[model samples]
Target chain A: MSSIISLKHLYKEYQLGDGSVFTALRDINLDIHEGEFSAIVGPSGSGKSTLMHMIGLLDKPSRGEIIINSRDVSTIDDNQTSTLRNSYVGFVFQQFNLLNKLTVQENILLPATYSRRNLDFDPIARSEMLMEKFGIISKKDSYPNRISGGQQQRVAVARALIMKPQLILADEPTGNLDHKTGNEIIDLFEELNKSEGITLIMVTHERELAERTRRQIRVLDGEVISDKKK
Target chain B: MKLQGVSTLFTSSFADFKRDKVRTALTSLGIMIGVLSVVLLIALGLGLKNYIQNQFESLGANLVMILPGSGFSGGRGPAGLAGGAEFDEKDVRSVEKVPNIKYVVPVYIHSSVITTADKEISGSIMGANEEIFSLINIDVQTGELWKKTDVEKKAKVAVLGNTLAQDLYGNPSDALGKTIRVGGMRIKVIGIANKIGNQERDGAAFIPYTTTFGSMNPKKTFFAIYLGIADKESVTTVKSEVEKTLLKRYDKDRFSVTEQSEILSTVDQIFGILNIFLVAIGSISLMVGGIGIMNIMYATVTERTREVGIRRALGATTRDILLQFLTESTMLSLFGGIVGLIVAWIIVLIVRNWFPVALNLFAVILAIGVSSGIGIFFGVFPAKKAADLSPMEAIRYE
Candidate 1:
């Protein structure tokens, strides 16, 4: 399989209040293949969230070469970084982060609205299809506050997939849901990865959830401790 | 940006306003009051100025009153009477020599009663020289004016105003040759002056100064002088020559010369002061309204933090965020200003109907400019606050 995202010798550091430096990610190199369902698993303070943020293009690494579809994004400015994120990346935050004021359909259409490329797909039809596929079609017009947590997460996932991005970065997408809902969300991600041929990168502390993916990487205290094919 | 897009922003703003109707109404009320105060105050000032100007016009155009005083300073008493010195027939003769002096009339005034065979009306008798008719531009409606020959001979001929003629004789035409007793002396009605409405002259009766001084009060001195300049451009030269002539006649600082230019300038000064006073009051109200706008904008920024975050995350530049808030503020203010202008115009119409004032367009334009400026000035800080929000922090904000 062709690699959709490649990171070489990535390093991310943060300045502590006392002037010391804390390394969040060090000497990390990884390749995310097309149509792969992968997870970065770690304990608390293990830099798993930081790695997810860097991969999502939501944060810049201190030193790294990140090539997504042959574009070197690490050297790009903020505007260009946003453009790259809009064109090639999708993010599903742990807390859902659905805009409370927007309806479920509006939330789902947000990514498409922000993306650099204009998709000619009908928003209403696409929102209805995603909602119907996720078994939340009845909540399409409802506000985020009116929907359940699992439904809101489904809406976020729908929003993430709206732009048909090359890579889907999920930072603990199911962390806030119950076991059944978490399993259902993971199943949905797997289904999307297999059928749509889109890459999936998830972060989680749950071993069972991380074990479900085809590839798993474990981080400990800002360092990748292990990488294995499940 | 596209018109459709701008309209969409407006629609969303209105929707948000609708969601919080009470707050929106309260904010709009603040702006409304501010704009209303500004518009109404300026309108009122303009209306008063127009009324005063019209009153002066009715008095006559380029009409200057030169009273006997010391050196153009003490001519008239505090009540516009001939006080310190007396301007007599000789001064009138001298003033006529000045170029552009269209007519100079010396007046001797007295309060008296006029009586016919059947009726009597009491009013002021204006004893004026023959030139008074031309100086005041009085139109004769009946019979001939008291001629210069009549003034030199002191002919007992009177020109009754329309009202006085109606009072003394039921038919003004019949009174043309009829005799009336004024101040116990009989005088023939030679002419009936045209009616000039319910002004000071409406109740007056004119007679030749020669006849008045020689027949009724021969020992009394002349009271005041009135001069008519040909046009506005000639007023300054005529006034200067009249002043120099008067100063040569009277003691220094004893006589006062007042011109239309001086009176108009005084009126302008009064109006200017009134404008400043009213604008200050309006500005205070506008500031209060601006504060309300600021508070509302701040609340909007807080409430829409997540939306701001979403836009920022979606590649919205800071300037775009700033422009959005500014557009909202400007829209609010512009609508408020328009409403204020309409209300002011309506009120001006009502005032014009009920009073003697007219609305000036300058006031209207000034109100709009100031109100819109207030809106933008007050909107900037809030817009900046909204634009400066960090995407990460705003996204995390509840």
Candidate 2:
């Protein structure tokens, strides 16, 4: 399969208030191929979230090259990087970061609204289809705060797919939901990756969830300790 | 950005305002008051100008007057120069000869006491010829005007003003044809001019120039000269020609010629300055309004930091964030401007009966423009702050 994302010697660092540097990711190298359903498993503060941030183009690595959709975008300007994020990458947060100000439908259509790239399909129609598929069509007019955690996450997932992004990155997408709802969300992710051939990259601490993916990469202290196919 | 995108952004921004009703109204209040003061003050100034213009128009349109003692010096005259160096018959005769000059009447003015049968009163006495009444277009209310033969004959006849006639005798008709003592001369009343509200004629009496100089006071000279031009448009030409003739006959330092147009323009200049000063005061309030918006927008930026992060993650460029916040603030101030206009209209309607209050379309447009401009000007710093936020950190903010 063709590679959708490739990272080379990536490093991330932060400066503390006392003028000392702390490394978050050290010389990390990895590749994610198209249509791959993968999971990065690690304990809290193990740099899994940092790696997701780097891959999502929401951040810049201190020293690294990142190729997204076969194009180098490690040092792109803020506008170009945002455009790439909008057109190529979609992210689901652990907190189900649906804007409370927007209704469910509006929240689902948020990505398409800010995208500079012309959408091939109508956003309203696409949002409707996704809401129907996710069983949240009845709550389409409700705000994020009014819906249940599972419903809000479903809206967020629909939002992530609005622009038909090539890659979906979830940083603990089911962390805030109950077990049943979490499994349901995983099933939705599995269906997307299997039926639609969309690449999926999820970060999780749950061993069972990580095992459910087709491939698992275990991170320990900002380094990949294991990579295994199911 | 595309039109649809901008429209969506505006809808979101407007929804935010709707969610915080009281805060939005309070934020817009500054702009409302600013625009209110501007519209009302400008309306008042224009109204006053219109009222004064109407008053000037009521007085004959073709009238021109001459003041004594130097046009350049404002007629204050040199120190120790008595009032004797005023306009005389020579100037009046020369003015009459100028083209477009229809009539010229020399006026000899003085304050005097008149003792009639049963009452004595203090009043002004104007010594002028028969042409003087027609020059000012004062209509005769009762009795006939003095004839030219009466002026040349130096007959001691008088024409009382409406109020003066009423004061002297209980009725205007009672004063006519009766002999009354004025300035120590027993003058018979010939006529009474129509009552034209409070004016020079309303409180004074008219006597022949021949009568004043020939009988009452031989030492009196013409106080001023009034020239009646045949047409109002010919005033400028007559003024210049009158000036040249008077300047050649009497030194330029001795007299000043003033057309009706000059006085009107001087009034216009004063009103113009006044309007500018009032508008500046109004602009200060508008500027304060703008600053108020800036302060609130700064607070809003702090409150919506997470939202900024969310929008950034959703593919909003820094420029989009900037424009969205900017549009919100602009709509805020523009809303205030519209409210201000409505308030000013209500106020004008309430107060219009007591005072002249004209609505100027230009001021309305300027108020709207100024409010919108203030929105953009003040909204920038906070919008920039929001746009410059780091997306990762913002999304991570609780």
Candidate 3:
């Protein structure tokens, strides 16, 4: 399979109040292929989340490169990076991050609303289809808070897929859900990966959650410890 | 950003205002008061200006006046209250002899308590020649004006204004043939003038200028000379001749020859300055309103930090976040401005009977423009703060 994203000697650093540099990720090389269901797993502060940020193009690395479609994200300006994110990346946060003001339909349409360019497909049609598949079509008019936690996560997933992005970045997507609900979310991702050739990247601290995915990349203390394809 | 995106953003921002209705009103209230005071004050100023303009227009425009001292240079001469060249009978006669000058009416003015048997009013009395009535468009409502023979004989006959006649005798016609004291001299009221809606003329009593020499003006010098031009085309020729005649008697610095339109334009210039001054005073409140918007926007930006991060992560550019907050604040101020304008318009309409208050187009434009400008000016800093937020940290924030 063709690689959708590739990283070369990636590094991330932060400056503390004492003027000392804090290295969040160091000397990392990785690639995520299309139609693959993968997980970047580690304990908290293992730089697993930081690595996700770099891959998502939500941040700029202090050193090394991130390549998507042969373009270096580090070399681009913030606005260009934004355009890249809009066209290529989709993100799901642990908290769901659904705006309280909009209805579920509007929340699902949020990504398409902020797109600087017109999308290839009709956003309403795609959103309706996604909602139908997720079985939350009846709750389309309700607010995110008015619905159950699992439904809110479903709406968030619908939002992430609205742009038909090259990859979906789920950051601790099941961290807030119960075990049963979390398993359902993972099953949904697996189905999309299998049935529609969608690339899925899940970030989690739990090893069991990581093992459930087709590929697992383990990280500890700003370094990758292992990469395994089951 | 695309127009569709902007519209959606506006909808989102407007929805934010609905969550905290009380705060929204309170935030816009500052701008409301600012626009309110500005429009109201300007209305009052315009009303007064209109009143003055109507008064001047009522008098025929084919006229000129010679004042002592350089009049209407935006500064009064050292003539001290009754300042300027004290034009007398000789100056009047010389100006009257100038070609195209129809009639030269000399005037002597004084303030006095005019009294009847049971009533007295502090009033201004104007003493002029018999031709003054026609020259100044003073139409009589009752009885007849004094003939030219009365002024030659220095007759103790006075014409009362409609309001003044009403005040002393309770009816304008009741004032005719009654004797009222002008200063210390008793004069018989010969006529009651038409109600002209001009404050100065409506309140003053008119009499023969010759009669005032002994009691009202011991110096025997006329206050001003009013010249009615025979033809409109000869006004300029007559004006220069009158100026030359006056300059021969007194220094040019001590006297001025002014046409009717020049006087009107000078009044317009004075009102322009007055309007600017009033607007400056109003701007202080508008600025305060802007600052209020800014303060609210800063709080909004801080509160929405996580929201901003989410939008950015969803591919919203920094420009989008900045524009969203700016549009919201501008909408707040514009709302305030429109509300304030409506209130001011209602007030102007109510007071229009007594005062000629006008809610003009310039005021409307200024209200909308100033409110919008204030919103943008004050909203910049807070929007910058929001745009500069790091998405990862903001989303991770508790």
Q: After superposition, how far is residue B366 of candidate 1 from its true place, in Å?
A: 4.3
Query: What are the per-model DockQ values?
Result: 0.22, 0.43, 0.52
Off by over 4 Å in 3: B1-3, B73-76, B79-85, B169-179, B184-186, B247-253
Q: Provide i-RMS per model in Å.
A: 4.4, 2.3, 2.3
lDDT (10s digit) by residue, model 1, range B186-296: 988889888876444656788888777655667645677788888988887887888898778676555566775566677778888998898788878878887888888
lDDT of 1 by residue, A1-230 (tens): 88888889999998999999999899889888888889999998998877877787766789988888888788887667666666577778778888776688877876555444455666667778988999888997899999888898998888877766788888888878998998989999989988887789999988998888999999998888998985
Q: Across residues A9-82, which tens digit of lDDT does each residue of candidate 2 receive? A: 99999988999998988888999999999999999999998899999988899998998767888999999988
**Chain A only: TM-score of every candidate?**
0.95, 0.97, 0.98
Error of 2 at B127 (Å): 9.5
If ranked by lDDT, best first, what sequence of candidates would result?
A: 3, 2, 1
Give the whole-model CA lDDT for all candidates, comma-separated: 0.77, 0.85, 0.87
TM-score of 3: 0.92
Q: Fraction of reference contacts reproduced per prediction?
A: 0.12, 0.45, 0.52
TM-score for each candidate, following the candidate numbering: 0.76, 0.81, 0.92
Q: Give stretches of model 1 more than 4 Å off.
A: A111-142, A147-150, A175-183, B1-5, B61-90, B96-102, B106-224, B230-241, B251-277, B354-372
